[model samples]
Target: MNISVIGCGYVGTTTALMFCELGYQVVAVEKDSKKLAMLQQGKLPFHEPGIDSLLIKHLHRGSLVFTGDIEEGIAHSKIIYITVGTPSLPDGSSDLSFIEEVSRQIGAAQNDYKAVVIKSTVPLGTVDKVREWIGKAQKRPLPVDLVVNPEFLREGSALYDTMHPDRIVIGSDNPEAAETVKQLFHSMSCPIIVTDCNTAQLIKYTANAFLATKISFINEIGRVCDAYGANIEEVASGVGLDHRIGPHFLRAGIGWGGSCFPKDIAALINMGNNNGINLLIVQSAQQVNQDQIGYFIDRLEGELHGLNNKTVSIYGISFKPETDDIRESPALKVIAEVQRRGGTVAAYDPMVFDKHPELKLPGVRVARNMEDAWKGSDCFFLITEWDQFSKIDWGQVMQEMRTPLVLDGRNVLDARKLRSLGFRYYGIGRKTGIIHE
Candidate 1:
């Protein structure tokens, strides 16, 4: 079987490679000349673990191909997966221009029936709009099946998640279209869900919204735990052990921020507003996440007497570890807030600074390494929990820093150990004072 994937981005590239691994020939289409060239040379435009090796292997074996021509991609396969981006507009609604343009292109180029699978995260009723767009672009009446196949892959472990998905959703008005798309993943052992386009789209949004709600709910509780001098880790462990609430997304930290959660949550809220329904829980979740940065800043401001002229070293830049994606990263928010308060900032990341040397954060100094980030700084703030961060020698950090103050934004550090090393350490909701041994 041959598969064509449009818009070679993070999702598109990963999706194309995934099909190749499943023993299907894949033609990946990219409009960007530079990215397309890089893909042809077996290099990824973005950083994802374990994908580079697979890409190289597939390219060497002639199982996968990259192209700049959309018509070539459209002609290669009966299955066309639209993995283009649907970025959030200022009004919190999705910008569907990319999807619209891609649909028209597919329509104009197709000579026969095509199973047009939309893998992008879009608003409800977009399937009907896509069908209308394709119909208008055609020279004459043609048969095309619109399928909504929302993706649920995480950024860092996208390849793993793609290969081992919890469930595969196929949304189509036509039963044959749904089954045809479903058969593409016949070898995978996950449950296949067949439903209407609207329901499938809602599943994607609802899943992200619920996960965001969980993170916000725990952070809100972490605030109360801080007020009473209680341990949030223990609370989360106890609550998560309830069997119904398995232990995921319950780790209380600064808040959830990434490409998907923030945009999807906002879009979901906008969808509610358009329907005259107020999603109070989701609204509160957004508010809580926004407020969390300020809460952490307030603690830092009080500890340093003021942020004015204070040198604070940020330990990570990406939203999470193992990926260089910084979209809506909490670390950026922290840097901006600290600078806004008249503080000096130095930052370090394992991958981001190296991958994007051209990335310019105004008035911020990028450090060469982790040790360079902490030198002569008044406070050390760890925003992203990269594995190397947890293995740092605190004794060296203690001697090098002008002031031995540590702020663990992700609550990943050993609070008791830091305090024992003559450093004043603070985590989100960890118990303060005497460590009993």
Candidate 2:
């Protein structure tokens, strides 16, 4: 199938490239001239592992075309996937202006029976509104079918997620249109769930909310385990071994942050508020997530008498490993808070420094290497669990630091090893009575 993927953002770019790899002719549309120029030159505006090679190869193969002309894209393709951004508004509702505008364009541009699939994350009843917008824009009754197909791609592992999704959800009132959309992913071995538009929308929001809840639930339990002298790792392992609650998002850390969880949860809460319902559990989960950094800071302060004039080293900056995305990263919040308390901060990340040079953290220095980050620092905070961080020489770090302190924000380090190396180790929800206020 010839597919046109609109808006070459994170989701759009990945989907377009994956479709091209699957032997489909793809037209990737981007409105920005600069982005189009970059893509045309085999360059991506963002960093995604393995996608760069595929993008260059497909662009060379002539299977993929990047352009700014929406009409050309709409005219060339039988299936149009609107993968545009629906960012959160100030009031926590999804701003559907982009999708609405694109829908009108698709309606005006289509001359034949076309299946318009929504691959963007939108609110409930959005497809109905899209249909209305498209109907009014069209000159006459053109055969256009609206399908809701939300994406479940993670930032770091987006390429893998795109090819091997856990499930393919197709939500459309038109069964024929839904089946037609299913054939797009026929190469992949996965379960396909066909339902109405609302169910599909809720499924995306609910899935993220539940994962957020799991993180917060484990973190809250970690807090209790901290008060007592219990190991959160052992407790979480025991709970996860039950087979009922498999260990996926059970790793307790600073909190959940990315392009998806925070915005989706807020929009869902706003959704509940508009309908005269209060989602208490989801609300509490959000609240607990918000408290994670501060909670960790309190523990850190308890470890050191205070953070005044202390030089702290941060191990990672990206929210999670393998991507340079620092959107809503706990490390940024921690850096700001630590600086507010009169501490100097330095950070080292494999991807963030060089790729994301525009990343501005007030009163923080981007370090060159692990040694440079640890050199003369009072303590180290392991914010993101990059694989390289686990392999650092703790003995060398202890010798280089002004104070041999290690605060495991993600708890990915070996606490026992750090302690044996004569370094003061403090992990979130780990019971080590080494620090007393």
Candidate 3:
């Protein structure tokens, strides 16, 4: 089968490559000329592990191609997946202008039956809007069916998630069209959930919202554990052993931040408010997540008495590891707080610092290397859970810092061992062990 994946963003590019890997010819469309040029050369515009290699491999095999022309892509395939970005508007609703424009273009170019599958995360009733837009643009009635097929790809491991998804969701009003969509995922070993468009949309939003709630729920519990000098990891492990509430999203730290959770939760809250219903739990989740950096900053201040001229180093910048994307990263919030308190902040990340120079906030120095960041710092905060950070020399870190205070924001450190090495250690939601001199 031939497939055209419109908008060569993270979701679009990965989906296009996955289609190519499935023995289908794929035409990847991108409006950005620079991104189109990069894709043509089998290079990714953004940082996603394992995708660029596949892109190059498929490009060599002639299974994948990149183009800037949407009409060409639409004409080449019967199944066109609109994987464009639906970025959040200021009002917390998704700005679907890109999707709308693509729909009109597809409508104008379609001469035969076309299945317009939506792989982008959109608000409820967006599939209807796409159908309406396409219907209005077409010269005559055409057999165009819209499918709501939201993506569940995590950033760092997007390709893996795409190739090895746990479940495949096919949403459409037309059973035949939905079944056709199901055929696209025939190679994957996962249960197919065939549902209406609205249910599928709700499933996407509800899934993210519930996951956000779990994060906030545990962080709130972490705060309680901290106050009582309890171990949150132990508490979370005990709770997760129930089998009913499996051990996922239970890791407590500086709270969740990424392209998906923050915006999705905000959009859901806005959706709730529009319908005259207040989503109190979701609202609290947002509040708790926002307050997390402040909580960490407060803990730092309490430990050091003041951050006024202290040299504080941060160990990670990306929201999570294996990707250079710093969008809505908690590390940024931490840097800003440290700067606000007049502390000099030095940051080092394996994948972020050089890839994204824009993260160089005022008063925050993006360090040249790990040693440069640690040198002469009073304290260090581990915000992102990168594997390199887990393997850092703690004894060397103690020697590098003047005060030897460590704040483990992601809880990816050995607290007792750090204290035994004469470094004061603080892990989120865990009891602070004493630093013996």
Candidate 4:
């Protein structure tokens, strides 16, 4: 199976490598020469665990090819996966310029029958847009079949998520096109959902929005726990054990962040509006998530009296760990508020410093170590739950800070133990300190 994956970012690069590892001839198509050069030289532009080695293995075996030539990529493959980013715009709608441009390119290059898979997360009926773009670009009807196979990979664990997905969704109005796309994942040993294009796209939006709703639900429940003397962790754990509810994104902290959940929830609400529906549930999810972030900031303000003239240390920058993407990170939002109130902040993440050397947070200093971040810091905000941050010696962090205050935004830390160590600890949806007499 000859395959071409366009827009070699996290999704494209990982998917192309997965296809290559499955012994399919894969070509990663990118327009950025710098990115293409990095791929050609066995270096990935983004940090995804285990993807670099897999790309290197395929490149060494000559099963994977890297190029910036659109014609070469189109001519070499029968299955073209458009894995480009459709980032959310200011109006809460996705920026479809990239998707439209790629569709036109595929149409221009289509001389024979091809399965053009839309792997990017887009609004429903977007496959029709691709079909229309193809027809318009080629002047006559183009020999291209549209497939909706929206990707479900998380940023930090994208490679593993792609390799061992829960199920593969292949949607097309034409049965033949859907089956052809299903065959590409025959070796993956996962259930394939074969449906029409519109359902598939809606499934992506619905799934993401539902997950976001759960997160917001639990975070709001956390607020109740704060008011009452209930422990959210124990309550959530017991609720998750019911098997029907299940525990996935229910760890309730500063709400959902990263690229997917926020955008999808907003898009779903807008979609509901266009269809003349209120979508009260999805709208509450969006509003509650905004409150979820506020919950964290509120905790910080209680600790340091409105954040003015306080020096804080923010531990993680990325929305999640093991990826360099900073989109919709809770840390960024909280830090910006801290800066607004005459606060001085220093931040550090081992991964962000490695890839983006020029990454700067305005009104904040980038620190090199836990000590550096805590040297004169008044408080600490634990944002992304990176493994390194989890393994940090809290005793030392307590010793180094100007004030021994720590906020667990991810809810991964043991607040009681920190309090036992003579440090003031705070957790979202929890009481101000440990429940001690």
Worst 10 residues of 2 by lDDT: 428-437
Model 4: residue 437 alpha-carbon error in angstroms? 5.7
User: TM-score of each candidate?
Assistant: 0.98, 0.95, 0.96, 0.97
Best by lDDT: 1
Q: Candidate 3 residues 1-437, lDDT tens each?
A: 89999999889999999998889999989999988998999778788999988999999999998999988999899999999888788888888999999999899888889999998888888888999999888888999988988889899999999998888787999999998989988888888899999888888999999998998899989998888888899999999999999999999999998888988888888889999989999999999999988988998998888998898999888898988888789998898888888788988888886676555477677788888899999898899988988788888988878888889998879887888888888887778533452
Better of 2 and 4 by lDDT: 2
Query: What lDDT does candidate 3 reach at residue 14?
Result: 92
Given candidate 1, what's the lDDT at residue 137? 88
Q: What is the overall TM-score of model 2 with all chains considered together?
A: 0.95
In the order shown, what is each candidate's alpha-carbon RMSD? 1.3, 2.0, 1.7, 1.4
- Highest TM-score: give the candidate number: 1
lDDT of 2 by residue, 1-437 (tens): 79999999889999999899889999999998988899999998887888899999999999999989999999888899999988888898889999999999888877887889999999888988999998888878898899999899899889999999999899999999999999888898899999998898899999999999999999999888778868889999999998999878888888988778988998899999999999999999999999998998887777777989788898888888988888778888889888887788998998888877677777787898889998988899899999999899888888889998888988888888888888888886777664432
Reference-based lDDT, residue 338, model 1: 96
| Model 3 vs. true fold: TM | 0.96
- Pairs that collide in candidate 1 are none
lDDT tens readout by residue for model 4, 1-437: 89999999988999998888777999889999988999999999888899888988999999999989887898898889999888888778888899999888888877777889999999986888988987788745657889889889988888899999999998898899889889888898988999999899998998998888898899888888888868888889899998999977788788778888888887777777778999999999889888776777777777788778789899888888888888898888888877876788899887887788777776678888766887778887888888888788887787788888888888888777877887777776656534442
How far off is residue 337 in model 4, in Å? 1.1
For model 3, name the residue pairs that clash. Answer: none
Judge candidate 3 at residue 281 and give its lDDT: 92
lDDT, residue 23, candidate 2:
93
